[model samples]
Target: MCALKTLSLFLVLALFISPKIQTTTFQTIKPKLSILVDNSKSISYFKEEKNLQDFIYELKNNTRVSDKFEIENYIFSSDLQVSDSIDFLGSATNIYKAVTAVNKLNSEKKAPILLLTDGNQTIGNAYEFMSSEQKVYPIIFGDTTTYTDLKITQINTNKYSYLNNKFPVEVLLNYDGIGAVKKTFSIESGGKTIFSKRMQFSKKEGSRIITFDLVASKVGVNYFTGSIEKIKNEKNIKNNTRNFSVEVIDEQARVLLLTDVLHPDIGSLKKAIESNPQRAVTVSKVADFNGNFSEFELVILYQPTNVFKAVFAKIKKAQCNLFIVTGTNTDWALLNAQQLGFNKNFLQETENYGARYHSSFSTFLQKDIGFEQFPPLKDAFGILNFYREHQDIVLQEIRGVETTQPLISFLEQEKQKIAVVFGEGIWRWRAASFLRSGTFQDFDQFIGNAVQYVTAHKNKARLEVNSEHIYASNTVINIAAFFTDTNYKFDNSAALEITLTNKETKKKTTFPFSLRNNSYQIALENLSPGVYNFKVQVLGQSHSKYGSFKITKYQMEAQFTHAAAFKLKQLAVNTGGASFYSDEITRLTQDLLTDETYYSEQKAIVKEQILLEWKWLLLLIISACTAEWFLRKYYGKI
Candidate 1:
């Protein structure tokens, strides 16, 4: 009776374990998909590699997540880099090429390709390529409009304005529009419409050009926004509008020109700085500085003697930027006392040599110090050479045999910033060189660059653009901006407005906020990947500044690797994600709806029935108890 009971128990246990073993089988599903693309013509504005990469990512990712299909991506084009292929590695973008690749894919698996393009097929068998696959679905972004766009070719005007004077303005416009229509354009300046005119398009086959002028009533630099009447089929609206900046100077920039003698270099520099009459640059000798030096953006010192030490000391204490020219009579004693000393070898004597008559203009002379006519200093001697390398020197003269060096340098001694020009004799070029190089305008542009560079920090309120970054579709872009104001502290009270405009779509978005530490943040999100322009305007007690921002599409996948499996799934499809081009991932997932295929494709299954083997653990405890009991029963435990 005990033996019969044991057999029956064994049979019952076997039946129970058999069912568990049958249900523990594992399965894997690999979907097959193919990619078809048309790449006959080349896009001049953008790269084709980007389009292909985006399509492949979508195809592989879509197939990876779906249990029903594996992908075989392919491309067709005149120049074939990859044929119809199931492999992840290869390149071909033409339609016929894609069909060839499709034919090579495994037949048993499903086929699909997320095809993408701009629809500019110029070469290859387009008919054959398209006919082979009726399942091609493409996502396009460019080449919707064929009308030639009218764009602002160039804009030239004074950077700053002289109050209540007409500023010379020039603008160039180009387009290929219907000759029948006349376009009227208007310019908005400093919150007011300053100029408007009617212009006709060229009747000829080419582009039309337009030029005009504007007047200003402000003392500071003013930005102008221009627009032309939009046509019925305008290619791009962004091209219809333009921006320019002009400085209106009611009173000219007062320049305190301090010099011991009537040096020709000083004359040249003064001519350059005073080139714009609107800037009130008062050229005063050093003798009068004690009572009159307070009203100048720049203090230009030309070969000043020790007698002028008091004037320089005052300028230094005022914390204003200086452009000091050194010569034989330079106040060495005062310079040493003020810690503005030059190298001992800065001066060297050279023979009187004459340069060959080439009649050339030095790049330095063209800089904005405002000289009307920079005549080259003729054959003169007593040359003083600079020993130190000073990159801050805005422009260097067109040299002969003399090795040119930086005469002006920046000194940061005793926690002060001072600009020093080591020598004189720069004047001889202006009184003489002007007849040769036709480029010598009324003023010296070199001094303009110098003053601008030195006083970059003095301007209390300023604005500038930081970076132009790019991202893919639905991306968040960070636009960095810098704002500084010596008069007003940046805090919650400060207001700034950011305007973003899409050149392609002619869409505008504006955001307003406050700032801190002369800085602010503007986050741009959910934007389509393309080239975008952003304008930042800051309104403060001192001045208003405008800056631009640019954003680009993220095209590379170096950051997306196998480690980012989850993100890869999101890139292609989520249950049903959107894809570009002739890529058909939908067919691959078709089998997912069927019961047999659904059961067969078991990739997400968990293998372990119950994780910890608790029954085995319980058996171990029972075994230990049995051993203990056996020991006590057989060995007579105490």
Candidate 2:
């Protein structure tokens, strides 16, 4: 009876649960995507009817047709002022800042970006943002031609102005087109047209240069706008207009100069240095060397009385260039040791007892050589002169030299190219020129040129690496270096050693390199991945350049793993769900979203053997019959 009851229960459970198990399958769910617009400076160029806000409305309705994605919106210009009711990422329209914000998005797992830009990245670095791993879809909308229009090339004026003073002004204009084209242009300053002219350009050349001279009549930074007549089919009109700000100043490169003794020769030299703004030279009589040397890039020491060794040492240590002016009091032995002494054979000595020195433009001081002759001055005492043989240096003097020196020389020193002026008496040239106009009255220019030559060698050296984590497996790594030595002539044979040092262990390895252009590539395959500091030293015969490089800590997994897995899991848990493995994807995706009776009804199915029911019962009946037969047979008639 118990067996029969268990069979009935098993049959009932199977009948109720089988249909529910076969009811449903699974499917995937998609998330919403958001779009942000930058309605800042770039938008102002377009009319109000064609603004970015209206454009956003168009994208919203069009994107709504796709049921796979939900859309959210946000807008920003100078600041994040407003956000829609939807949860959206706020953004700054500045190209660089916007890229940074989008690159950092953590919530949206699979998102797309749409960017509309003029390609004019003014405020921030757009290229840097795009160089990263972010996916950017750009719709460029600005003018493409760079320099095919008439533009202002240069503006020459002071920074401050006087209310009604006439000042010299120059404007340079260039037309960027092949073939000759004639056009009329005008210059407007302070809301008034100061000059206008019709110009012509040759069709064969790239650009034409136009010069204009105008008078300043305002007392502020006068705004000047230059515009040429608009041409038909011109692609961009905005670029055709050029503007500049010019200030009228009471003084220009005004220098206060002093020398220890009232020497005319020294005065001439100082005056020559301050001649042009190119590199102004100023001299102060240092009764004592207490003032700051920071004000000047170059300083001159025309022989001092009771000169202290400490003073010479201080001058040597100065950040600025120092030109030592030799006099009769200078120690000749020390001068020769310092490589400033001149060979007596090079001197041009005068023998006449009664003689007059006349200043004339020497072939050596010609304009091409960078020297200008001072105005002719007579009655100068004839003296011995020890000068350079280089014709180039001579032309520089003849072009116009207000300051005169008896000796000038150059020395190729270790790590430095030193130029020395051995003798003085330059002030006499200035005094002699004052008696006559047109003698290089610009003594300031002469001295300024000399000083510039001495200090121009101090270059700005800065180094930056392209990447912080250079993979050890990488065969070669690239580095970008920037320096201010525009006139550098690099020697290709120079070699550099780059040494990488482990941060914690202090272990170091060095790689030597021969130059392949201005770049150096060192193999990194042998080095293990870790935080390392690299220092590069360039070896040159005279001077050496040094820089440092840094390698960020590297993790092998960080470079190769899929970054999206973590975010996918977070989305699953936060929504009260479990992540599905790829193997079980078909079931999890199809069934998880289906409505099922199994979850609603409490039922289960089970399987059993027939021996527990029909077979066992039959065996029991046979055994009972056999026992009765045996009892009857044993009793009487078997």
Candidate 3:
């Protein structure tokens, strides 16, 4: 009984006296190491596949390095992918993208990167200029031995040319380690050599530029191949040839200018519009207008009188683009009756109005021609009342006071584009521009861009599809679409479907567009090199659109012949690291293991607990009290 009572007293006192205690521990965190291996096609040129595999195997098996690091492996070419194996079969190399990917993946915890590559970047930005917080050690894979190689570096030419017109093609040739060698450069089209020339290089390493003029005779896509004859001991033949395509359109856009009387402005406007090679202008008097108006894409009217009302009606009915120049002879009452865009109350007086360029115009890019510097236009003083909203106001009138009254404006109404110039004597502006700058480029560009914008085709359908007309074979094709309600507001509640047909193979592919942030988009991948036609339609609606695009067979990997050692060195220097060759990879490993920055980090962890609330304390107290009660009852002392 005495022992049980004493135990109960001790248990109760221990609970009140106990305090919380804390224990601390320290652990070493292994440093993170990221290894990036180049799997691009260029790595295969130097037979470095086995060497890369051996290097990775040694690193992972080395206890000194493996014990210090938590490793991550990645293989990259044009894209970054996490993998345990490397395959040297990628079509192109994008070193910049690989570095960027590592930086993004380790944004929270910066890890040191070990890169193995030939540093031949055929796509994306240069990796040398990319900044990162982690050190990057680059191990070059290819030999630095110089060899003889003649490569066609670049071919510059227009992608589109008019039929029967001669276009210029410039070829850039690079020669390495060959001195005083005569090489033959040839251009072939339709499997026949059309032009050939012999060029002699005097230096062992240099670049030569060759220019040729070729006629675009056919009205279709013309594929041309430029080649340099292989040398006696040349091993790399892929870079010696390159292929490009030019689309030969049928004819230039024809523009007709109809006027009531001959004016100097007609000649000025014709010269400016025809400055572009893709456009031609013809001027004729309104009374003698007998040409086919249907053939012209755009029709310009200069102060037409009531006699040409039939011509105006025909133009409106045909829905051709119109550019109206209003002057003293303009019949405003008749023009207003047509409800073209605006109505004016003539005061029977004329005044000169200078032009002020509007900064808020969005229809087209405006030129920096200094509209304020140009001469004034002879316009009638009137109260103009606009009936419809204008798309953009290119030029506003500045008559002693700057006013919002538009002098030149573009409008779209009833699916037709109309541009109105409410004055005359624009010839004076062209003359002034030439007098100031000694060139008519600014003035010509201003007029030419405006004319092109108003005459360009406008899509008024509720269903509109947007895509580029040309794509490279390796690129993914993304087609975007938009749906509109009856009032031209965005409506995406309807499902849309597109059917793509390969023109040559007659194979069909159907895909449904997925809704993406108020629009619809679909991605098409691995499309072969050919022309494809697509038709899109909205389900349960009559809205449909059709178009075609072409993909070219071109690979960037075939253009590069040697590795870029200087770039790889620069990347190492920029990140406070060093460069090494493949044979010196061991030195890189030793250096990383010895570097203090890569050492493991130790952190201490502390924890605290209250002993009074422990379950063992409660059980002991219950047992002690029960034993004391039992003893007291047995001894008859309860």
Candidate 4:
């Protein structure tokens, strides 16, 4: 009876007392730490490489700092890599890549970063623009001494020149020293010193611009080397010499202009096309032309008459590019009967129409030639019907109100490029442009671009590969390809493969292109500086294409002879961190440990058993009272 009374009393007290007794726990969250190490070629200039290794080892193994953070390490040059070994063989340095890599890896859990570098960023964005959310402590390395360097800064010349023509070559020479010195600047081509000059540098640190006129004597890829005699004690000699190549082409495009009568438009067109040294223009009347039609690559017809209907047939048979200008004299009946891809319905009248530039024209870029200021062109009042579905409209009509009627348009039919101007009086455009802008450059560019686009060779292959002919060593080679069926529709159902070979090393590497948005593209990285030959082939077909490109050597690491401490310090100041030298790297450990913001954070977890949720205890109390009442009632002591 006493034990039962004791248990009943205990049950009633436990429900109220359990709510007061709660358990608390604390969880310590260690702050994350990221380490970025420079693996560029410049790091090899450090005198004591062991000191750098020891510092890295100490930072990684130090328990006081390591225990407080979850550390991750990475190495970077032009790109980021997660690795422990530092070979210092990377040819470029990009500090921005280091920060971006760390930011991507620790995006969810931000942390402080420890950057070890020489601060000599060569290729990529500036590291000062790194994300501000994470603090960065830079440990700068490399020599801070000043040294003399004389180098060729730039070479300005065209990539292609005509045969036997004199081309201008400009060389920029930069010198850094105290004393004046005499240097010999020379240019060598075809294993001979073609040009040489002696120049004196008197300024402490300045640049000299030297110009030379060299004749393109050979018809091939001419390799030219511009160099300066090396000075004593120069920090870097690799940049003292530079190599550039120019292609000398012997073939010139012949353009035959067929006109019904003498007009200023013929002279204007001739002058514009001849501005390019690679083009020659010949104007002749349709009845006076005696030359073979096959001799010309392009033909411009101005208002063709029925007298020369056979001339049009000869041009079509030769498959030459045509720029047809239509006016009141055009033989519309004969032109329409020949099925020249367009038909006209004349109203027996002429109308004046101003030009409104078309926004969707992408065949060739349009220049700002003030089309609105030019006088309107005279066109036969008509409605033109185009047979082709894909017409590139360059200009629209604004007779009184803007209409969608094409004033100037281009069409591609049966492997022939044909451009049509629905009006006449383009010569006025040139004169008006000169009056407004005081120059005919805009008018000339507008006509020149159109001629260039039409004269360019069109590729009719179902599979096409496109890539730049030249790329820098640090840049990724992105090659894109387009595949089409026999009906000229994009097809991505076939597998594409490419075999890249280094010309110097004769090494072959094969890669498969990944399909993206109905096209095939592949990105190749880490290709050494050299000429590479590539061949692309599509599976299940004999279709293939071959190409070659050059990758210039990356000398960015040699551009800087000293570490950039000011930039590193500025980055540290902006990111709320401290800057230290390599010798003071040990201080970084202590600073991070002492920093209140970098310490481990603790979160308290309190657990309480609420009286309402203690259903077993409540049941026990109810049972105890019931048992007591039952016993009292049974014993007649209620």
Candidate 5:
């Protein structure tokens, strides 16, 4: 009785303190079995939709299999989705994507996968090469039928072509029929036939590559279709034709390299600017140059001195873009007196400072190309100050101390977009970049982007968009937009929406954009095949932008006439799992039930519970008191 009273008093003390107590209990966690069903339109195209549905129904309804393992159902098309609804209407088949997704989501469970697919993956990397320990048991479907069909396996063409230039087109053709088949392969654009050739394919020689060239006379987006004449009674006619597009440009931008002296840096700058096929660089000395300064889109003054005074005057009057390079030979006094864009207060000596990246530079999105490790550039030793509020791409680091002085910077003050590199001897940087990255692409690309930004016209528009010209059917349209305030800073509070108008249906729809990662992003779905013209407009502002993209009437899932069982079998064998056909459901279930590799595991689950919040604990305390009192009364001690 005294012990019972002590227990009651302790319980009361625990309730007053209100301390949380944790207790660990063990429970059996059944090993998860992940089912990745290919809900792709290819199954429906192969006429095996019913067969796949029946197999899924039987497997899901099996009580014995469900009772043994925790089942996770997923479906895949162009991408993977966790779903119980199987409509067999997925537009693409990416088995590798499905398997990789399951591996990631169930990384802890290391769940065994049961994949159901025709094995016709139209996108993503190869599944057979995926490195994971989780076993993948692929239930192969659509292997029973083989139809006579000819397919345009692939079409290769360039994304852009110079005007009036002949662009090459290569078509890969494949025929699965038993005999030698002949078909008329043709190319069409704007509903008119452009090129035609007769191609032959046999069972032994089942594929052929036909290459031809077409003249790009027009200067705009040109759509083309490469197709083979369909054979008699062809079931998979969707794969008979392939559509592609090319953008034709009129001319390249002209850039003149005007320098007063000759240096290796001049060669490096010229080569870097010319690396982009769109920009042509012409090197000329200021004294010998007699061309029209305004003809060139940009003029690069290398190590400019008093000799470039007349050239700068002409360029300033022209209002053309300028990329100024200063070094040991630069006449800073004259350049500062001219007051083009920026001024540096340098001492008599030229100092060598290391480069430090500035992450807050938002004039453009550029990755740090490992500039901090490169050899320092030579600039006049002083407090290099800017006249305007400029953005620095790389700041100066004197010895080990990072300074506020700008090494490479950009400023627009005198109605001219100017980029200045307050240094020289960057030709050595090419070799240093190659030594670091095994290639000069990083350095060359950085230089090219700097030059491109300087030469490119200032886009004062408040709205900007980055998107593709074409998208495949059933793929999500991810349109990204950037809305800025009048001062050109990104505005997050702005209400931006996109209005898409279908060219064919004449129907318009609007969708709002969500803010993510400092940008306005929107994902659109269920858009039909047509050319969509979209306008991104700010709600309360008059600023708007327009663009168009074509959604092709193409489905990757319908490109298959039969299943690829061998690939799935190889994948299963590589992952320590067995491959079975849809008819082998019984054997698959038995293997799962009998395989000791899969079993429930006991795991300790520790849960924190409050002392006074448990109603059952209070009842137990009362029962203890009541029992103690009843015993004491029965013993005549009440």
Candidate 6:
């Protein structure tokens, strides 16, 4: 009876007490050691692949170093990657990018880095000048000794030029010989030397810059090769020659601004049309004009009077595009009689009308541009009545009351397009656009879009391809295309494909463009240096678009023959680390093992929980109480 009573009482008391527990443990944290190996093609040029692999193998296998630190392996060429690729076939070497990547790893324990490279960077900023909190120990590969070499370091030139225009080219030549020498620097085009000059270099002055201009006589794709005379027994002649390309275009459309009187509106129209590089504007008085009408794509008739009768007759005969602007000075009677798409009824009285953008206008994509806030334009109080069905882009408002009269309208009939602006003083609108947006781009784009629509070809293309004409060898080239239906609406079901052909090798490659972001696009990651022509077409359609692009011959990895020991040394010094050669792997491993600053850390973890909630303890208490109660019940007499 006493045992059973005591056991039950003990269980009740323990549950009420609800004791807590405290558990302590220790954890060992190892210092991080980041190892970056170079996989760029420059390492193969220097013949350091074997040395790099040997160093990585030994460093990872060293028992003492492994025990003291947590080692991580990384590979880098132009970018940093997690594993090792010993192929040494990367196109570029970017040491700074690799180092920056190491710094970005999420870790509380700062790690020391091991960099292996030829110390030559083809892209990114200079690595030696970069600031870092972690120490960088650089292992340089290849010959560190300086040699006598004459090289072309850099070249600067324009990628585009007009026909018969001169483009400037600048070349930077450098020498590393101890004695003074004279050599010839020449530029060649079409297998002929177009320019040559003798350059003298001394030990004190080993660099020379040559700048000159070349005439772009041919219409398309002019390539030039610049070279420096090589000294005898030069170690590497790969860098002695460099080449560049310029695309000469001659298809700029001409715009004739024909006006009877000089006004600010004429200059504004000219500036807006010329804002587009594909269009050129020439301003002239309509009475004094005597030029070939076949050369111009669009003609601006500014405030025309009786003197413009002959010009209008010529325009109608040629079926050319026209932009007519009218104001107080315009002769409405004569203009209405000429039957130029619209008729105006007005008196000599003038009035100012505010511009109101029409929401339903679909002639072209119009920018809002805060048209309601623009200064009112001056014109004779009149209403323009279009004789043909047209689009009204802007309407006129008088005394804060919107009217049905159109301000800017477009009409197309009989293969000829005519756009009329009822009011003048558009120059003020241009100034207001600048004042609001801080740039004339909005106003200029608005004007340019309208002009483009007026001058557009009758046979519009269904598939439009957009791409630059030239690209460097290192950059990623992409071409995009947009396909539209008969109503100029986007068509997404049709598949688009393109075929790229190399002009030099006569080789052709086909690539398909995937629909992305409402446009079909394709990425051409790597391409050889040459002129390439491409044809893009819809699979089920008959129309196709043709274009061409050029890739410059640039191989930054092959430009340098020796390692950049000085840059590596400076990088090590700046980061408070040490520099080592390829054969110094053993020494590096020993230093890492002996360094006391980077050591293992011990962290203690403590945990606490309610002891009463333990399942095993609760089960034991219940079994003891039940056994005691059973014995008491069996021994009872009553």
- Candidates in order, TM-scores: namely 0.38, 0.30, 0.59, 0.56, 0.69, 0.61
Q: Tens digit of lDDT per residue, candidate 6, span 1-638?
A: 67766876787788778799999999999999999988887888888888889888888888888988888889988889998657887778889879988988924556999999889998877789887778899999988888898999988887667888898899999998799989999999998999999999988999999999999989877878898888889887888988877778887888888887878988888887776656899989876789978789998889888888788788878888988899878888889988877887787899999999987664554557889889999988876787787888888999899998888888888688899888889999999988766667789889998998899987777777877776656556878887877765567788999999999999999999998755778989779888899999899889799989888765678878689999999999999889999999888888877878898899999998787765665786788877876876788932
Return whichever of 5 and 6 wins on lDDT. Answer: 6
How much is 61 displaced in model 6, in angstroms? 0.7
* lDDT of each residue in 1-638, candidate 5, tens digit only: 98898888887776667788899999988989988888887788777888888898999899999989899888888788888788987766777767877898888675899998888898767777666668999898885567889999988877677899998888889999898888899989988999999988889989899888999989877888888999999987988988888888888889988887889999888777666556789999888999998888888889889888787788778888888888999999988877775677778898888898887675654568888998899978877656676779899898878988888998876467888888998888888888766667778888887876677666666677767788878877888877777666678899989999999888999999998655678998889888889999889889899988988887777778888887888998899999999899999999999998888888999999875775666776798799899989999997
- Residues 1-638, model 3: lDDT tens digits: 67867877887888888788998999888888999999876777777889888988988898888898989999998899998688787777888889888988888675899999988887777688778778888988876666788888888887678899999999999888646788899999877999999987756447999988999999877878788998879867778877777778886888999988778888999999887767899888888888778899899998867877889788877888888888877777778787777888876788777888776564554545778887888766787778787854545555667877788888777767888888888999899998766678789988887788677776546776877676656666888887878755568688999999999999999999998755788988888988899999999988899988877665666555666788889999999888988888679888988998777788999988776775788798899889878877888986
* Candidates 4 and 5 compared by lDDT, better number: 5
The lowest-lDDT stretch of 10 consecutive residues in candidate 6 is 359-368
RMSD of each: 19.7, 30.6, 13.3, 13.4, 8.9, 13.0
Maximum-TM-score candidate: 5
Error of 3 at 206 (Å): 2.3
Per-residue alpha-carbon lDDT of candidate 2 for residues 137-230, written as tens digits (9 for 90 to 100):
3433322334345544545654344445554556565665555677777878656777788877654653555555556565434556677775
lDDT of 1: 0.49
Task: Show model 3 residue runs off by greater than 4 Å.
Answer: 1-27, 82-85, 104-110, 129-131, 162-166, 202-205, 218-220, 249-553, 604-638
Q: Give the clash count for model 5.
A: 0
- For model 4 the local lDDT of residue 97 reads 67
Ranking by TM-score: 5, 6, 3, 4, 1, 2
Weakest lDDT window of 10 consecutive positions for candidate 3: 359-368
User: What local distance difference test score does each model get?
Assistant: 0.49, 0.43, 0.81, 0.79, 0.83, 0.84
Supply the TM-score for candidate 5.
0.69
- Model 4, TM vs. native: 0.56
Worst 10 residues of 1 by lDDT: 555-564
